[model samples]
Structures are given as C-alpha cells and as structure tokens.
Target: MIRKLYDVIVVGAGSMGMSAGYELARRGFKTLLIDAFDPPHPLGSHHGEPRLIRHAYGGGAAYVKMALRADKRWLELEEATGEKLLERSGVLNIADPDVYSYEGRFEDAAVHGVSIESLDAQQIHERWSGVRLPDHFRAMYEPNAGYLYSEKCVAAYKKVALQAGATLLTHTFVTNIKPEKSYVTVSTKDDEFMAAKVILSAGAWFKTLEPFVHLPIRAVRKVVGWFEPSGKSFDAGAFPGFTFGNASGGYYGFPSIGGAGVKIGRHDTGVEWRPGEELEPFGTYPEDEDDLRRVLESFLPGAAGKLLRSAVCKYEFTPDDNFIIDTHPEFSSVLLAGGFSGHGFKFSSVVGEMLADQVELGKWGQDVGLFSARRFAQEDN
Candidate 1:
C-alpha cells in the first residue's frame, strides 16, 4: 500500500511529542503524531497529576536557561489554550548542608537574576508549621517555582495541535523506523508513513529505536503515592511543593491539590524496567509506600496520615541524567529526544519548540550543547 506523506512524523505523542507536533503543525507542516496508547494514559511518564517546575534547577546551572524558557512557553500555552496549567505555589529545595551543596544553585540563581530566598531550618519551620527540619538542613525557596498539571498540559497541547491540523493516531504502535538519505519512514501496525523529518520522543520505549540512535538510555520503574494530610497545613495555600535531599537521593512532594491529598515520591529509587514486560499494578509495591512514609515522618510528619493511593511511572535515564536532544549522527532526517531522567515533563513546552526548530530551521535557537548526543560519543573517547 502507498504510504501517506507528512512534513514531520512524531512518534510517542506524550509530553514532548505532543508539544512538538503542536509547534510543527502551527508552522503549517503536515504533521502526524502516533502513539501506542492515547496520551494522558497511565502507561507513559506524563500521567501523574502534578509535576514540579522550578527556576532554581537542582540539575545544574546550565539547565536554568532551559527551565526559564520552558516556564515562559508554558505561560504562552496557557494564554493560547485558556487553561490553567501552571500553579505558582512556589517550591522549596531542602537538603542537609553536608550532603547536598546549594552553592552552585545559588550561583545559578544569582547569575540569572532569578528570585530565590535562603532559609534556615528554624525559618522553614516557622514559615510552615507542618514541616520539621533539623538545624543542619538548609532550604532555598523559589517563589516562581510551582507545579504543572501533567494531564491537563498534555490535553491542551493535543487540542492546540489538532486545531493546527496535526493528525493524531491513537492506539497505534510503531513497529520500526527507516531513515533514508533525505527522509524517514515510520511503520505502524496498520500502515507506513513517510516524512521529511522524524522525531523519536518515545519516552521509556526509546530503547526500541536504539539501533537507529545508539544512546545509552535505561527505563526504570518508579512509584508515587498520595497520602491524607492531618491538617490544612499541607494545602496549596499554606505549603509549597518541596524536595528534600540526602546522601542517597531526594524525596519530593506536592501540596494537597483539589483534595487529592499530599502526593509524594522518591527520586532515587527505581528498578530497571524491561520494555514489553507487564507493568505491576498501582499500590502493589508496599515497600514504596513504606519508603515514602519514612520520608514524610522525617520531614513533614503531619502530612503522612493515610496511604490514599499510588501509581507507577517510568524514567528513561542516560549515563548522565541530562536529556538527549540532537540530530542522528548518521541520519540528520531523524531527530531524537529522550532520557529526561525523571524531571523532564516541565520542560516539554520548550523541548517541543526546540524539536520543531531542529526540523524546520536545521538548528535550534537555544545553545543545546549540554543535551547533545555527541557528548556521550566524546565521553566514550
């Protein structure tokens, strides 16, 4: 059968792919977005209700610019869609001073002129009565940092992309990708499609495309839990989204939103997940609940009331947890973006724009050298 031709084909129409599809379609490209399941589905990464967005990035100073840019684009999307996507309830990064250093974060904030407030453990407890921090822990609060409604963000992107004439194929699984000299062809279970440029934003399923783009990405299963808070202190009005760092890793949580209770998760604990394997049902991992309970008991004891519910998600990690956004080394027509590590959902807005720019202009506006796939190649040397 003759395949349909599009200007750009976006695989995995989740957070990053949907945004890129919107940008490409808005630019008048005949864009086609394909996904195994409908987006906003629990099977993918961007499913859980809220994801934190912060300007004072814990990842590194180099990411501050992208984070800020993503924040701006999110606002633009909100205005365009007329949907409340971002909630500026602020964010707190607390860490034991000896284990986690905030010096680089402070320098990044100062250099970028982003607003950040430093607070001691006493100050933190005084400001939010529900929190119990030891004297040795330090905190940095970014008033602009907050949470984004994950499902709503994806829906808004999809709405805008559909309005802009992007074709979406839900429940369609991609079987293979073939990159030619000037164009790329994508094979789905039902049919084949060709595009001038193809983007593989396949999230946890990225390993399926490993032969085309050899990036060391591993899919790991992680869990998040919602708990009933004892008092109103954990509400959005009083408490902010927070992260607590330690020698092992960190635990992050969001205030109770829409009566969903305080949602918490550990950033460091995830087991390697093989693709095509059955994913465990939600609330099946009792150990995850125990770990989260331990974190809440240590930091915000009042927030750990009852184990309301839990869900599992996947994070694709690179050797270095930074994202991989670059053209294929051999086939320029094929672009790849994955390895978001666990903190990529917030930047989906800007990442989409960058992917679209890569396809349309042959370059992106921002200095994306930090996320370049070539870095891994250089590291191998």
Candidate 2:
C-alpha cells in the first residue's frame, strides 16, 4: 500500500552488498541491505573455510590497482574489528619453472608494482615444509599473499554495518526492480520500497537479474574441502599456503592451525551451474571432492589426509575472469558488482568503497577500465 525509500537500497546482503551498506550508512546515507539468506551462506561465493588474498593476482595487470586497494582495506578492517580475519601466511605458485611463472605471472606483478620472489623447488621445500612441490616445479612467491576467514569476515562486516545504523533484512529476497528517471522501485516478498539509488550485487544471480541490461557474467559451482592431515605429517609453520599448476594439480591450500587441518580446493575446474536449487545437493557433490582429492594425491600425499568438511559455492564469472564493478549504463543509479570469477572475497571491502564511491563521488579513483561491463560491449545493451 505504501513505499519505504532509502538513499540506496542494496540487493543481496552478502559480501559486496553488506560491504556497500556498511560504507554507505557510515557515510551518513539512508541505506537498506536485503538478501535471500543470511550472511556468509554457502549458497554463493565467499564460502568454504577460507579464501585466498594475494596481491599478485594471476588474472592480469588490469587488477593491480584493485588488488592493492583491497590490501589496504583489509588492513583497515583488521584495525576496525580487532579480529584476526586475515593471515599473512603468504602464497606460493608452484609450477614447472618454464610455465606458470611466465609473462603473465612476472609481468602482472611488475605492471601492478607488486613485489614477488621466484624460488627453486628446493627453496620452497626448505622454506616451507608442509609444502610439497613436484620434482621439477619452481615457485613464484608473493609475501603479501594470505588467507581470509570468509564467514567471520562477513560477521564482522554485518556487525559493523548494523552498529553504523544500516538496515539489514536477511531471509529476504528481492523479486524485481523498476527503475524510474528519479528513483527506483525495489520489491521484496513482503514490501515495496523506493530508493534513490540501487547497487545490484546479487552475485551469482546478477547475470539473470540484469539480462535486459546485458552482462557477460555466468554462475559456476565451486567445491572446496577442509581436510584433516595426519597429525604428525607437518607442523603449522612448515605449511605455507600454495597453488599448484602442472600436469598433475591446480589446487591451493592452507596449513593446520589449532588442529584445523589443511584446507584445499581446485579452482580452475568448477562445475557448470545455476543459482537457487537446493544448494545442498549442488553444495556437496561427490565428484567435486574427488576432483580436489586427485590434486592432493599428486602434490601432497601425506598432507591431504581426509576430508573433514566440504562446501559448494557459486562464482559469478566474467568472460575475461576479471570482475565487473560499475554502475549500469542504462540505470546510472543502479550499480553492479558481480563476476568475481571465484577470487572476489578479498576485494569485498575495497569493492564496498568502490560501490560507495560510485554512489557518491562518481568514481572509485582506481582505473577499472578492464573490469567495466563495457568491455563486454557486444553484450552490453
């Protein structure tokens, strides 16, 4: 019968939306954040026990700016929360010296001005014992790389957001949107509301939600495991996190802390999938765990002991495997933050600032040309 209005109504109260809502409300904007489920749900990305945060991104030089900014924000959040959400455990990329450490690897870091170190197999083994490199594989190590606690981070953000006076409506689904010249209409199951602006950060659902706007984002299912290694197999300090690529494995993992075991997953081989279909069956697929185990068997036999727990989450993928973080061309007031390509969690805080900036100053001060939906202009209606 009536409408509730806000300066900005953010759809999907997950990583991106919650981050945006926190920043917006902190900046004194009237904001509302809505989601179909609770924060840090395994239904979308930013799940599993942890997500990797590496400034030396494998995507390309285009992300150098975003990655660096994200690093700063992560530090800022750490200060804000006083919770140990990020670990500076560092990240290692293990592959044959000739391949993964090629133009893309070294050049991306150089272009982004991020620091890196190349290590021989022996160096990796001696430096980090939990690490198991193949016979001839070398490594490119990024010191700033680390891991993030996905669920805890979301909890931190949600708490900060509510403290800052933002309205967060969980278990609420936004069914549709109607954008007008001066304002936008947002419809949930129980109510209709008007918003001066809208940030469409529905993650996996972004592709279908904005078909009329034409985005290149697609949703893919990713499975990861929290594995309990043999208690005596390796010590925590010896187990530096690593991502391996070769004829054998393309998996990444962490060391056991407080008997948490080594958490591992293969990133490149997620199943083709959609959103919202009883995520349990899709969440813990039999084949996906097997797919990751194959990596453990090849690379780290003693460490990949048994799967203690596992989860399936969806990644919003773009054609270039980068991210799309800008306002929609058709609806300037409607910003889109999707297509994280399975590597968007670490950037959530910075992306929050970017979305907030777009809704405020009109630019995030970072050159995100490569991430613009305009790059997919053929599909960019």
Candidate 3:
C-alpha cells in the first residue's frame, strides 16, 4: 500500500485535536485527524454533557488570560456553527474564609478585568436559597462564568473541520509515531502517513507515545454523580454552577438543566489509572457517592435529594496540574498538548489555535512559558 502525506496530522480527534484540525484546515493546510474512537463517546475526557468555563480563575493569574481568550473562541465557534454551545448560568466559588483564600481568584479577576462579586454567607443564602453555606464561609461570583456544552463543542469543531476539507479517520488507532529530521511518520495497524508537522493531543492515552516523546503524563480515574433535586430552586434558571473549596479538596456541581437533575463531582478524588485496565462501574465504590452526599448535605442540601446515576471519566495530570503545550524536546517537528488535569476542556478552543500557531510560526503566538514541558526539565536540574 502507498503512504499518504499531509501538511499536518493531529493524532487524537477529540477536543483539542478536532479544534486544531479545524483551525489548520481553515488556514488552508492539508490536515488529517485520526482518533482511536469516534468522539462524543464516553471513552475520553470530553464526554459528560457540560463543562465549566470561568474567567476569574483560582488556578492562577497565568490562566485568566487563556480563559478570556477561550471565552472569545467559544463565542466565535457558536456564531460560526449557529449553535448554542455556552450557557451563561454564572459560577459560584465558595469556601471557608479562614481555610482557603479567594485572594488569588480576586487578584486574577482584577488583573484580567473580569467582573466578580464577593458575597458573604448570608448574602449567598439570600441570593440562592438552595445553597446552604455556613456563616463563616464566603463566596466569589462571576456573572459571565458558566457551563459549555462539551459534546456539542467537539461536534461543532469536527463538522467545521470536515467542511473545510480536513480528513477525519475515527476508530483508527495510532500505533507509533517516528519523527525524522524533515518530517514525521505516523503508523497505524494497516497504513502509514507522513506529515510535515504532528500534534499529539491523546488525552489519557498519551503514554502510548512514551517511546517517542517521554513526558510525565499520568492518567487518573474519576467519577461524577447525578442527584435528583428536591425542587425547582435548583434548576438552571435559579441556580448556578458552583464549587466549594474544602480541607480535603474541592467539590463542584451544575444546576438541573432541562430537568436532568444536578450533576456533581469531586475535583481531588482520583486514583492513578493505567491504560487498557478495566474501568470499574461508576457506583462500584460506595465511598464516592458517600463523599459527594456529605458535601451536598452540608453545602447545597436542596440539590441533593436522591442518587440518580453516575459515570466515570479520566483526567491527564502533570506533576504541576497545569497544561503542557510545547514541542517534543527531541523532535522539533512534533508538538504535544496534554495533562489537562480535569480542568482543560474549556480551553480546548484557544489551545487548538495555539497548537496551529506553533505548527506555522514555531511559537504559540503568546507567552505560555508556564505550561511549557521545559519547566519539568528545569526542575530536574
């Protein structure tokens, strides 16, 4: 069989890869997107219906700019596709004032010119009666922060990519990637393809590329549960997406949209996962549900009525819990984007743009030093 060639090959047609393929094809680059499974499937991280998007980031001021850029990109995609991808239902970041400080989030908001409101416990209670915060806790509210329809976002990007003349091969597993001095070759079981540039956005399966580009990417298993709300007060129109920071970790949830009930998950509850291992059933671990129930009973009692259903997902975590968007240290023709750490779906739009920029300009068109894989290399020295 003859080998196919292209200007760029994106290995992983999920969130970031699909967006990158769209952007590259829009720019008139001959691009190919290959994936192990058809996306919008429950196999990857981008599944679950909704993902939170917030500009006032508590992660760091470094991320606020990216969040802002992502917000614009999401709106642009919505306009292009004529689809409602984002819902501005607002987001509440609540925590005990003494334990965890909202100072970083506040500073990030101020620096990025993001509008936010500081609310004490009583004020939070009065504004949203469904939420029951302790008198000592406080909250930071961002009116523009909300949830993005994750599945819809990926589908939109894939559709636009196909319309722009990009080729997509789903259910095609990439077995190897070999980077040469002039071009990179990608091999599947049946065929081989060459591309002037390559992008690896393989999410949890990124370790499969360890033979070519070894980055410290770890896959972690996580669970999210849906609970039946007691009343309409927890509906999308009345309630907003929320996160409560605690000593053990943080817990977050979405409002009941379209009578689907409330969906909640723990941010810090994940165990190291190896690829190819069987994923246990969602409710197999009783402690998972019990832990979420404890948080709901304490903070948002009205939203936690009955155990509805549950699902499992994986997060690719870096040692620093930040993203990695740099060229492979040994292969300049290949770029990598992984280690989203469960908070990356919202930034897929801008990240795709950044990856395209790296392919064409040899730089990301912005300062992303914080997310560079070189940080780990430096730490070793």
User: Residues 1-381, candidate 3, lDDT per residue (tens digit)?
Assistant: 569999999999899999999999999999999999998789889987899999998668668988999999999999999999999999999998778988888888887799999999999989998878778899999999999999999999998999999999999989989888789999999999999999999999988776777778888888988899897998997899988897867888899889888999998858788878887777777877888888988888887788887888998889989899988887888898989988999999999999999887777966688888889989999
Error of 3 at 286 (Å): 1.3
The runs of at least 3 residues in candidate 2 whose Cα sits more than 4 Å from the true structure, single-residue gaps closed, are: 97-99, 108-113, 207-212, 231-235, 280-286, 379-381
| Worst ten in a row by lDDT for model 1 | 279-288
What is the alpha-carbon lDDT for the whole of candidate 3? 0.89
Against the reference, the lDDT scores of all candidates come to 0.90, 0.78, 0.89
Residue 373, candidate 3: C-alpha displacement in angstroms: 0.9
Better of 1 and 2 by TM-score: 1
Candidate order by decreasing TM-score: 3, 1, 2
| Candidate 2's TM-score | 0.92
Q: Could you tell which candidate, 2 or 3, scores higher by lDDT? A: 3
Error of 3 at 77 (Å): 0.6
> Taking the candidates one at a time, how many backbone clashes does each contain?
0, 1, 0
lDDT accuracy of residue 18 in candidate 3: 95
TM-score result, candidate 3: 0.98
Q: Please give the lDDT score for candidate 1.
A: 0.90
Stretches of candidate 3 exceeding 4 Å from the true structure:
none
